[model samples]
Each structure stands twice: as C-alpha cells, then as structure tokens.
Target chain A: MIEILDTAPLSSVQDLGRAPYLRYGVSYSGVMDRLALRAGNAMLGNAEGLACIEIQAFPCRIRFRAARDFALTGADCAATLDGVPLPPWWAKPAREGAELTIGAPRRGSRAYLAVAGGIDVPSVLGSRSTQFRGSFGGHEGRWLKAGDVLPVGAAADAAVQAPGFGAEPPQTAFPADWAPPDLQPSTTAVRVLPAGEYGLFMEESQQRFWDTAWKITGQSNRAGFRLAGQPLEFAQRIEMRSHGIVPGVVQVPPSGEPIIQLSDAHTAGGYPKIGTVIEADLWRLAQAPLGSRLRFIPVTYRDALDALRQGDAWVAALRRLAEQYRSLCNSGRTP
Target chain B: MTAEEIAQIATWLRAAGLDTLELTSPQTRLRLKLGAVAPVKELAVQPAAAVPSSLDARATGLFLPIHPWCETPLVQPGQRMEAGEVAAFLRIGPLLQPVTAPSDGIVGRCLATPGKLVGFGTKLFEFSPEGKAP
Candidate 1:
C-alpha cells in the first residue's frame, strides 16, 4: 500500500485506456503520456498497460507503506527518496516508510510512478484509468487526494530483486545507454496526416498551418491542446453535422485556433479538423511543456505506420536487454 | 620502485579501467594512483594520511557540476558522500549522465575541470575511503 501525502488537483490513476467504449459516449481517459507510463512499467517488469500514478502536479509527496521497488519516468521532476535525489527514468527499491517527493518538472510534464506490481485498483469498463468527467473509474472514479491509501498489486518474485543485482550500476537514473534514440522528445516538430477537412481551408491557411510554429496555450490539458498561432480562415463558411472523432484530431473552431483532441476529449465534435497528429507522435505532444513551441510536419500514411513499427522495435529491444540482465543475476554472474 | 615504473603502472591502470592498483613483493611494496589526465601519479610505499582513490568518467561528455546553473562544484575536497550518490554529471547533448560514487568516501581532489569535454576513462575526482576500504 502507498499513501498520498500531498498532491495537485489532476493527479490520478491511469493505465493504457478504456478501449472500445467510445460508441457509448465514453472517453478513453487514460495517461496523457503513454510512452512515459509504459517506460516506467517496463522498468519494474510490469505489463505495459498496468495502472500507475499519473502525477501532473508538482511537489507531490507519497509514502510507501511496504517495502517495494518503484520506477520514476517521463518528466524529470527532481524526485527524491527520503531526501536523497533519484535518477530520472530509473527503478529503485524503497524501504517501508520511505517518502518520495517530486518537485517541479525540469523538462516535460506528467511524471509516472510505477511500482513493482501495478497500482491495485478495481478495473472499470475494462480499464483501471480514472475518467474524471464521468467520475466512475479508478479509486472511486476521482483524482487522488492527500489521505487516500492505494493498494499495490502483488509483485512477481523476479520483480523484487535487490538494486545493483540484475542491472549494472546505472550511470544515471535514465537508461541512457540502452533506451531507443527516438524515445526522447523531438524539440521542434511533430508529424501529422491531413484529415478530411484539410482541403476546405483557404490556401494561405493551409500553408500557414504547415509553416507557422504553434505555441501550446495554458488552457491545454488531458482533453485537448489549444495552440496559439495565426488564426486559420476557411475558404468558405460551411455547416456540417456532428461527426465521429478520435484523439489526435486537430479541430479548428469558429475562433480559427486549432485544438488537438487528446485522450480525454469527447468522442464526437462538429468543428473542422485540418489534420490529425499521427498516433506515434501523440506521446510527444503529451509531454510538451505548456508554452513550448511546436511545428506540425505532414507525413504520408505509410510513414506513420513505419514510425509505429520503430517504437515497437525499441520496446522489444529493451525487454530483451532486461531479460538478459535478469538471467545473469539469477545465474550468479555479474552483468 | 622508481618514478618511471610508477608512471607506467598509472597508464596501465587507466587502460584496465581501474581506480587504484597495489602491488607487494618481498623486497618492496608499491601503490599507484591515477589523477586527472596529467601525469601526476602518486607512489605510496605505505598507508599515508591521504589515501587517494581516483574516479573515472563513466561516459564521454562535457563534465558539469550537479546543478548547471550553479557555479560551485558539486563535490569538493573534505566533503563526504555515500556510495551510489551522484557526485557530478556528464552532459552529452541534452542528456545529463550522472557520475556516481562507487563507494562511501571523502573527496580529496577534483581533477577534471568543469565545463570541459571528457572522454570515457578520463580521471575526474580523487577520494579517500570514509571508514575502511571496501
């Protein structure tokens, strides 16, 4: 069990998401940064989609009620275990009563804390993710509070190995030498694919959309990112009925500003969508700090598929390396 | 042993990825310590007041203090740190690789100049064990 000492308003439990429920008007409200959550889970030997704490607010404090190992990934929040600094994107064993404190993010946003076993929350609608709007899933379907005690799933025997046993002495908290090259966020651009409404926009608007750098506004959240840039004008005012939509759809409302739908966005919308960010690059936008500049580079459908394959390859390689390290430890050989 | 023999042993230590090497013979005993990139090898015949142990660069990058904004060095002479503590950092592109202490020790000397590029196996700091040598 782990107890929350202090936290911000949006901190909650999240897994991959509650999938295939959009037809029922339910949003797939899961982690904003899927890569970070998956990386943290992988470090602890948990399933990729296992539940973990999605910390959006900073200076959050958590206490371990039992001795267990945990991994911190995603944001570099200057985390400390009992006043000692912890390396980012690394897993360390914690003793009972150890208090972990996370400060403001140094880079990126949304840090993930995954324990050896996942966060033990009753799955709702096929997911352990908390959907704040409906208030029906994860820890009574709400954001985590200061006094809430969260149960941790039972850890596998192999997952509880001592530090410096299975893995070499980490040069940093992050697996700098082992992590895939593309896993790191690209500082400048995110790839996109044109949607149905791309041709409806004026030629200048289309050119600006591809050329202008958009600044993420403070209004952005798990719902969507409101980008600040040159307002895009349509070729002509046209009315359209509400249509089905998914996360990553870049919708432009009457104000001309583009809003990129995210994990918690509504299943349907009536606004014109100029383009949709590729699924592979959504994780990058999810971690983009507020007020950061971002550019959208158009890509072909084939390129988008190739990008996803690369991501899968990175994860597979990491798993193989981790398995080899564990085997060496079990065989009484130093890695 | 002569000073020339001691310098040769220091070069061998750098190649072997070792911090300190000690040798004993019936006639004489010698201990060689590597410090920084300079040829400042310390040859000790017996345990002295300062038993310096060298710390090597774990990765190739520009060496920086723990805090990039801070001007003061992360670890200084006479300061004590626990094993596994991050003593300094190596900045490779945007990533900062932490240089951790191998064992609990008191800082004796900082050899690598801050903000300078250092390759792997470059000597960075020298420290003496805090309690007994592990």
Candidate 2:
C-alpha cells in the first residue's frame, strides 16, 4: 500500500486506456506516455497495461505503507527515496515507511511510477485508466489528493531483488532522427503522415504545414495541443461530415490554427485534418513543453508501420532483459 | 592540513608505497606530492587521524559521478552515506550497473574521472567510517 502525502492537480492512476468504447462517445483518457508506463511494468514483472501513477504536477510526495519494489520512468524527475538520490529510469525497493519525493522534471513533462503489483484501483469499463471527463474510472475518477491511500494488487512473485536495477530509456535506445531535410533546426520534431483532407489545402498552406515551426500555445491540454503559427487555409471551404478521430489527428478548425488531438480527444470531429502524427511518436509530442515550437516531418505509411514495429521490439527486448536480471539476482548473482 | 596530519599522511603514503595523496571537497582541493615541498595553505579541515579506504568499482564500464539528467553529483565530500547506498554507476553500453558503498561512511574524494572508462576493482572514491574525517 502507498499513501499520498502531498500532491498537485492532474496526478492520477492510469493504464494503457480503455478501448472499443469510442463509438459510445467516451474519450480514451489514459497515461500520456504509454511506453514509459509499459517499461515500468516490465521492470516489476507486472503484466502489460497494468495501472501506474501518472504524475504531471511537480513536488509530489508519497509514503510507502509497506516495502515494495517500484520503478520510476519517463521524465527525469530527480526523485529521491528517503533522501537517497535515484537515477532516472531506475527501479529500487522501498523499505516500509520510505518516503519518495518527486521534484520538477528537468526534461520531459510526465513521469510514471509503477509498483510491483500495479496500483489496485478498480478496473472500469475493461480498463484501469482514469477517464476524467466521464468521471468513471481510477481512484474515485479524479486526480489523487493528499492523504489518499491507494491499494496495490498482490505481486505475481517474489523474484525481484532489493538492490534494484534500471532499464535503458527509449529515447536513448532508439534515438530520434529529427533532421528535417527542408526545414531549419526546430525544437523537437515528430514524423507525420498526410490525412484525409491533406490534398484539399492550398498549395502554399500545404508547403507551410511542413515548413513552419508551429508553437504550442497556453491553451494546450490533454484533449489537444493548440498550435499557433502561419494559418493553414484550404483552397475552398466545403461542408464536411463528422468522422471518427483518434489521438494524433492534426485537425485544422475554421480559424486555420491546427489542434493535435490527444488522449482526451473527443470521439469524433468535423474539423479538416491535414495530417496525423504517427502513433509511434505520440510520446514525443506528449513530452513537448508548452510554448515550445514543433516541426512535423512528412513520412510515408510504410515508414510509420516500420516505426511501430521498432517500438514494439524495443519494449520486448527490455522485458526480456528484466526477466534475465531477476533470475540472476535471485541466484545471488549480479547482472 | 596541520603538521600532525601531514606527518600522518606522509607515514601512510610511505607504508602504502604511494607517491601522492590528493583530496577534494566543495570548498577546497589539496595535493601532496613526493619530493616536492609546496607550501600548504588552508585546504579541507578533516579528521587527520582517520585512515581513508578506497571504494572500488564492481564492474567495468564508463563511470558517471552524476546522472545524465541532473547536474549535481551523487556523492560529494563531507556527505555521510549509508552502507549499500549507491555512490556511482557504471554505464556498460545501455545498462547502468550501480557502484554501492560497502559500509556506512563519510565521503572524501572521488578517485575516478567522470565519463572515463574504468575496469572492475578500480578505486572510485576515498572514504572513512562515519566518525572518521577522510
């Protein structure tokens, strides 16, 4: 068991998120960084998609009610266990009463904390993810508050060692090649594929979509990131039907400013989509700080599929390494 | 360093067959070289009588005193550390193997260079027991 000692808004229990319910108009709200949560669970030998705590606000403190193995992944939050410094993307065993303090991240925006058995919040709608909009899942369907005691599921086995270990961060494992051939150096770039209405935009707007450095504005949230830059105008206005939209769709409202729908995006929208950020690179977009400029690099569908396969490969390799480490540690050998 | 402390270090250097003794802290850096008598100014005011021992690396890899994400060093001079606490990490390709303290002690000087490749059993730091000033 773990108790929240101090917390800020937007910190909640989240898994990989619910699925097949978008037709009912439910937003698929979940953890912003899926790979980070998956890697954390792999380290603790937990099954894939187990719920973990997603911390967006800084300076949160948690007290371990019992000794348990846990891992911290994603943003380097400069976490400390009872004043002992913990490296980023590290796993360690916390003694009973150990206090874990998470500070402001120096790099990424979100951090994932996965315990041995995962956070035991009730699974709602076939998922443990918190749908804040629906108010129906995860720790009373709201952000965690001070003095909240969260229950942990029973661990699968006691094979994990106390000395602890770490896994390679995905950024380092698979370096992002952000060299946009036609554009100047941008803050961070994610590959994008042309969407249904890409050809309908004006020639200049289409060129500018790939050329301009779009700045994320203050209005950005989990639902979507509102970008401010050169307004992307269509060749001619036409009435369009509302279509199903998922996370990563870069929809251009009539105002010409584009909004990249994210985890909490509405199930359907009528806005024209010029492009969609590939699923493999959503984590990059999620970690982009507000006010930072982003450039989208065009990629083919084949490239996007290859990128997805590579991402899955990395996660599988890390899980295998973790299993090897656990067995070696249990046998009194250090890997 | 006091005269008595200098003499004690000199005796240890001779007994251990070492040529030099150097120590560093947040506020001071001191070096004692054999066959060269340099005027000793105020350096680290540590417990002179305490004998310092070496903390060796348990694996072969690149050494990092501070984490890649944070600017601060993990273990610094004058900081007390518990036994089994991580003092540094050895980065072997993508894996990070921890270098932990063998016993409770106060840190003295980091003997290994940050980002330099080191082999197993390499002396990484100089430390003494909790009450000892090394």
Candidate 3:
C-alpha cells in the first residue's frame, strides 16, 4: 500500500480515461500524457487501463505502506528515494516506510508512476480517474498535499514475483532513448479541422485563421487550452446556439483567444469553433505550456478518421505487448 | 436531459450521422416523449447564455483613449447609440488595436471583432438584436 506524503501542484490517479461519456456532460478525466502512462505501466507489466499516479508540476512526495515494484516516466522531475537518486523509468523496489521524493521539472511537463498492481482506488463510471470538477474518482477528487497516505493494491506475494535484474544501478533518467517529450513544446502553427462557425468567418477571416501566431495564455488546464493572439474575425454578426465540443475542438471566445479543448474538456460549449486539432496531434497538445505559439493546418475528414484508426491500432498493440510481458514472467511454461 | 442522458447524446448523434445539435434548458430532462421527436433543428437553446462578454477584434490598429478613466462601460444592451456615444479622445494606427466590442454581449463568443486588420471578408461581430431599453 502507498499514500501521499508531500505534494506540489497536483497528483491524481488516471488511466486511459473515461471516454464515451461526453453527451452526459462528463469530460474525459484521464492522464494528461498517455504515452508516458503506457510506457511506465509497460515497464512494470501491469494490466492495461489500471490507475497510475499522474504527477502534474512538481514537488510531489509519497511513501509506501508496503513493499512493491513501480515504474516512473514522463516529466523530467528529479526523483530521489530517501536522499539517494532513483530512476524515473525502470521498475524499482520500494520497501515499507520508504519516502519517494519528486522535484520540479527540468524538461518534461507531466510524468507517470506505475506500480505492478496499480493504485487501489474506487472506480467511478468505469474509471479510477480523479475528475476534480465532478469530484468522482481519485483520492477523493482533489490534489494530494503533505501528510496524505494513498492506499495501494499490493499484490499477494504468492501471485507476484519481481523480475530479476543484475545488481547494478541504471545510468540515470537522462537516457537518450527514454527521455520524456519536450518539457514545454512550442505550439506554433497548430493544425485544425474547420468546425462549428467555421463558415461563419469570411473567406479572408478563414485565411487569417492560419496567418497569425497565437500564444497560449496562463488560463489553461486539462479541460482546455486558452490562447492569446491575433483576434480572429468573421464576416457578419449572428449568434447561433451552443453545441457539442470534443477533444481538439478550438472555440473562439469573445476575447479573440482560441481555446482548444483537450481529453478532459467539457462535452458542450457556447463558443464558436473555428477549427479542431486533428486527433493524431491531440497528444502533443498536452505538452504545451504558457507562451507556446500556435497555427492551424487543415486536413480532410477521411484523413482525420484514418488517423484515429491508426492511433487505435497502435495503442491496442501496445496493450498486448504489456500482457505478453507479464505472462512471460509469471508463467513457467511458455509456448 | 438528466445528467445521465446529457451523456448519451454524443452516441445518438454519431449513429445518426449529424454533426451539430442544440438543446434548451428544459431539454435537460431528455424525456424520449419530448426529446426524441423534438425537431433536430431546434436544438439550439440559450447558446449565448453560457458565454460572458468579450471583444473579437477583426483588425489590428493602435488604440488611442479619448475620454478620461471611467471604471465601467456606460452602454447598455438596448441603450440607443449616437455614433460614438462616450467620446473622450481617439487614434488608430500602426498599433495593434485589440478590437474591443462597442456594445455589451457574450464576450469572446464572437468569431471576430469589427475592425482590426481583417482581410477582405472576415466575420466582425455576433450580438443579440438591439431591443428597447427598459
């Protein structure tokens, strides 16, 4: 078992996220950087979709209630185990009464820490994610603070066997192959699909859509990204009704800032959507921070769906690889 | 739409091949008797009610303040206009005048504000019809 000892900005349990709940006004409350989530989970041979600890920003601190194996990846936050350096990726053993400390990011923006059995938390709406807005999942739908102890789903010793490794420490979290994506990637020229109110803009207005650079403002979060840049224009004044919003939906507010909704964004919106970021690049949106420049590149609908299909195949394959690794280690007999 | 039904609309729309739909406050019930048969085109309810006031600048220019500092804007939604009602001072040029709204309405809800540096044909402002002031 494990729990929070000290925390920084935010840390919560997340998985692939609660999808297909948008129409009900439910946002997808999942990990911010899923690739990192999968990588860390894979490292520990855990089941797919198990809740992992998502550390956003830093100074995250935690302690174990029992001994277990876990993997950490994503943001470049420096981590230490009781004043000694620890790795951010490989599976490491944690004993009862151990304190794991994480510091501010040096490169990446978000990070994931996966344990073998994953975090033990009540599942809400088919997920263990902590949707703060709804107060549904996670250690009570809130950020962890100092002195918080999280319960872990420690596997029974009979059912668990740690993978054997040579008695040697790894090079470090700075391995070129395992580094997290850019800590704060620029958003210059974001690609988008014309959406609601897309035609409302005059031809030139549409042209201006991609002509200028927009800076991501501080008013950004998992729900959506707010941008500050050249005010976008339309042809005439007409107010249509509010409509549904999806991941990648870019809503232009009265402030002229274009807000691109993310995986955790609300299902519906009143703002006009000038464009949408294609699904393929939606993951990249999670890595950007304030002041990132952005522009939109358009693509055909067929291409968009095809891209989604491709991403689905890739994630599905990744899931198989994880299970296969677990089977290999657990079963003495192999095909 | 009960909070539960508001959740299923996405699947219903995708299965039906429609891209847009709007609903009013009462629709929150999503009673099949009143919802399924409701006109698909009538989905738009109080779209602007959700947004706040904003200024979608269409062009870029310098903003020169004419009047002295007055805390809040004086113009009301239905208030009559006299071609620049609150005149203080003025200037427009090489400056990137963040085109602000002349009248109050949903902020940033507009795709474009009246005059910034919009190309030949860009949307300018989207506002509610001017009604008689109370």
Candidate 4:
C-alpha cells in the first residue's frame, strides 16, 4: 500500500470509467486521461481495465510503503522517483521505503499512475472508480491520504516488461498498412459526430462552430467543460426537458456558450445537446492541457461508429499483444 | 401536426438516441429532452410537452431566475425555469452560490411545501411578462 502525505483539490480514483450505470444515477467515473491510463496499465502487464491513480491540476506526494514497479503516463507531469528523475510512458522498479514524487504537469492536464496489481479498493456497484459527486471509490471514494499503508500484491510476471521504449503497442493498421509510422503523440486535431440537436441551431451558428477555435476555460471539471467561444444562439425556441446524456455531449445552456460533458457528468441534464464527440478523440479532449485551443469537426453517425469500431479493434489488438508478450517472456524466448 | 402526432414524434426521436427534440403543432409547440442528471433524475424532461409544465414551489421564497450557480437562463421557446440559476457568485461556502433576484418576479405558478431540501438550482418562481412570449 502507499500513503498520500498531502493532496489538493480535484483528485480521485479512475479506472476505464464506470459504465452501464448512468441509468442508475451514477456518473461514468474514470480517468480523465484515458490513453495515459491504458499506457500505464500496459506497462504493468495488467488487465486492460485495471484501476490507476488520476492526478489533476496539482501533483501529489507519496511514500511507497512497499514500492515495486510502476509507470507514469499522460499529462507529462515531470515525475521523479526517490528524487531521481523517471521517464514518462516507461516502467521502472522501486524498492520499499522509496519516495516517488510527481510534479506539476509539463504537458497534459491529468497524469495516470498504474502499479502491477492495481489499487485495492472495495469495488462499489461493480467498479472501483470513485464517483466524486457521490463520494465513493478508492480510499473511501476520495483521494489517497498520508499514512495509508497499502497491502502487498504479486508483482507482474516481471519478464513482460518491454525491452525498451521502442516497442510497438500491439494490433492496428497503424503499424503495417500506413507507412508503418510509429504511434507517438503527434497530432492535435479533435473530431466530433454531428449527431442529435445539430439541426436546431441556425445555420450561422453552425458555421461559427466549425469556423473558429474555442478556448477551454479553467472552469472545467469532471462534471462539465465550460468553453469560451463565440456566444452562438438560436431564434429563441428551446425548451428545457431533463434528459439522459453521455460524456462528450456538448450542451448549450442559456449562456449561449457550450458546456461539454465529461467523465464525471450528471446522468440527467436540462440543456440542449448540440452533438457528441467520437470516443477515439475523447482521449484528445481528455488529454488537452489547460487553456488549450481546440476545434470541432462533425462527422456522420456511420463515421462515428467506424471510429468506435476502430478504437475497439485497436484495444483488442493491444490486449492480444500483451498476452503474447507475456507468453514470450514466460517461455524465455525473450526477456 | 396534432399534439398526438407531436408526442409520437417525441417517442421516435428519443428512440433514435436524440437528446433534444422539437415539435410544433397547430395548437402548441413542444421542446423536450431526456435528462440524465443524478441525485434528482426525476422527469427534468417535460413529461408532457403539449401541456404546460408545473412550476411547483416547495416554499414561499421569492422567485428568482438566478440559479445560485452563475449561468444565465437562455430564453428559448417553451422554456420555463423549473429550478437552478447556475450564476457565478462570490466565493461562498458552496462552489458557485446561486444568486437570487432582489425583487421577486411574477409568481405565475407555485405549490407551497416548506422545509424541503430546497434543491440546488431549482426554479422556485415563474415570471410572467405583460407581453406574450415571442
């Protein structure tokens, strides 16, 4: 177990985000930085949905009661293990009594820390995700605290650790079909699906949405993302009916600005949903550092489904590659 | 279209995974959404759009459009304040305290019940202007 000596606001337990529970009044609680979580877990050779630490605005200080191996990813928080600088997106081992300190983010908003066996929190409603609004997840559904002695768990197969930072991240057209270009964090474009309430707005407002860049205001959280952009409006004929919504659903309240729902959004809402973002690009939305400028390019539903399917296939390929790597490591074929 | 046809369309748009739907009938216009908020997911969506939504008041507090959270209400068709003023306020005990209007607006609808939770961002009053809704 680990101890959280001190922590500030906006930190919580995040897995692959709780799901199929929104209908029960529970928000989809999970890591704000989804890709980072996956990368960390992949380093640990754990299951895909393993729980990980989600760091927000400020970094956290921790003293590992029983340090083993861990990895950091997402948000590029300049991390230092026991005062020695550690690389991001790579795994390393630490002995007991070592202090691991992660500083403020150098790039993204949230950073993910994943260990081998995952955080040992009592799962609620079948998830270890901390639903902050409801206050229940890891460490009593709050941030970890000092003197919190974590229990010991089995180390990952150890042999499965990637040879170096140059290994591939498993199945994808990203490897063979294209130029076999490496999958690095390269582009910054965000995509959206022109689904739902897009038609209600006047043509001018729709044009404005795609024609300009929107700045993300600091007034954002798991609940919703308040954006700063052109105050678009309609001919004054919208009714507020409470309804079910999902993450990435852009809602236009009376303020004329749009509030994009995120992982910790409310299950029901009263605003008009302009559109939903594609799942693949939601990672980019999640990874956006503060004050980052972003734009929306709406795609058709078929395109949205294609993106979803592509994401699913990619994750499946990663899982299979992880299993193969484990087998290879165990068989002494490569170590 | 008739109200029956409009309501039926609401059912279909919802089936199509649509969150916002508008139905303009010869007698009435309806805007509805299926809200998925928590702690109080009760029909935030107008259960019946053809009929007027009730602004049931829990207490005798003066009606204010301010949600206590700083977001101003967007004036739209068939729109009514059920609750919440999302107005940004001074750093108070609450995150964004809902600012209430000093002078009460017209109490177009209210059902008195005191000592309730006084839900955050609930529309406690309905203001009526002398001029008709545009």
- CA RMSD of each candidate after superposition: 9.1, 11.8, 29.9, 29.3
TM-score of chain B of 2: 0.59
Ranking by lDDT: 2, 1, 4, 3
lDDT scores of the candidates, listed in order: 0.74, 0.81, 0.57, 0.58
lDDT of 4 by residue, A285-318 (tens): 8767657766777677787677667756554544
Q: What is the C-alpha lDDT profile of model 3 across A196-276, one tens digit per residue?
A: 689987787688777666677888878778888668776777676777777888888776678888867877778888888
Cα lDDT tens digits, model 2, A240-320, are: 899999999999999999999999889999999999999999988878888888898999999999999988877776676
- Give the runs in model 3 whose Cα sits over 4 Å from its true position: A82-89, A154-185, A188-190, A313-335, B1-134
TM-score, prediction 3: 0.60
| Position A15, candidate 4: lDDT | 86
Among these predictions, the greatest TM-score belongs to 2
For candidate 2, the iRMS in Å is 9.5
How far does residue B32 in candidate 1 sit from its true spot (Å)? Answer: 29
CAPRI-style grade of the A/B interface in model 1: incorrect
Colliding residue pairs in candidate 1 = none
Provide the lDDT at A200 for model 3.
87
Better of 2 and 4 by lDDT: 2
Deviation (Å) of A208 in candidate 3:
3.4
Chain B, per-candidate TM-score: 0.57, 0.59, 0.21, 0.22
DockQ value for model 3: 0.01
